[model samples]
Target: MKRPNGEKNISSTITLYADDGREFKQTFTIPLKANTPPPKPGYAVAKTTGTPAYYVLCITVPDMDKTAGEGFA
Candidate 1:
């Protein structure tokens, strides 16, 4: 759910700065799509080095799904 400020409940806004000291705040929204069955509940964000990585390496699942529990919806 989004908060009053339009920020997602699971995340918060943060300021990012470049090496040049330029700072900016960006609003990002994560999508939920599972191609394979979840192994466990919770989520993960994998970091990669080089070539501006961060291309499709994350997980977002409810606690129940991560713990082998049934999802309510």
Candidate 2:
């Protein structure tokens, strides 16, 4: 999530099921850096490489029309 017209990489996919029907899949790659300054009770970003990596959920809407709330306060 980089502004100034650039940067934004985020890919994700998680599915797991078991109960007579088995299924498992996991993949994630999150790298959004715009100097990392967008956190107001919300923040996330992680991408380490396989073997053991986590923290994929993210939310960084710097302006997005005031985080989609419209009348931002």
C-alpha lDDT score of every prediction, in listed order: 0.55, 0.56
TM-score result, candidate 1: 0.21
Over 1-73, each residue of candidate 2 has an lDDT whose tens digit, in order, gives 4355334334445566778677756544554545443445567787767878766767765454554345753
In candidate 1, the residue pairs with backbone N, CA or C atoms under 3 Å apart (3 or more residues apart, or in different chains) clash, namely 40-66, 41-66
What does the lDDT read for residue 64 in candidate 2?
49
TM-score for all predictions? 0.21, 0.21
Residue 15, candidate 2: Cα error in Å is 2.6
Native-vs-model 2 lDDT?
0.56
**lDDT by residue for model 1 (1-73), tens:** 4334333334445567889998766855555344444346555667777787765556665554344346454
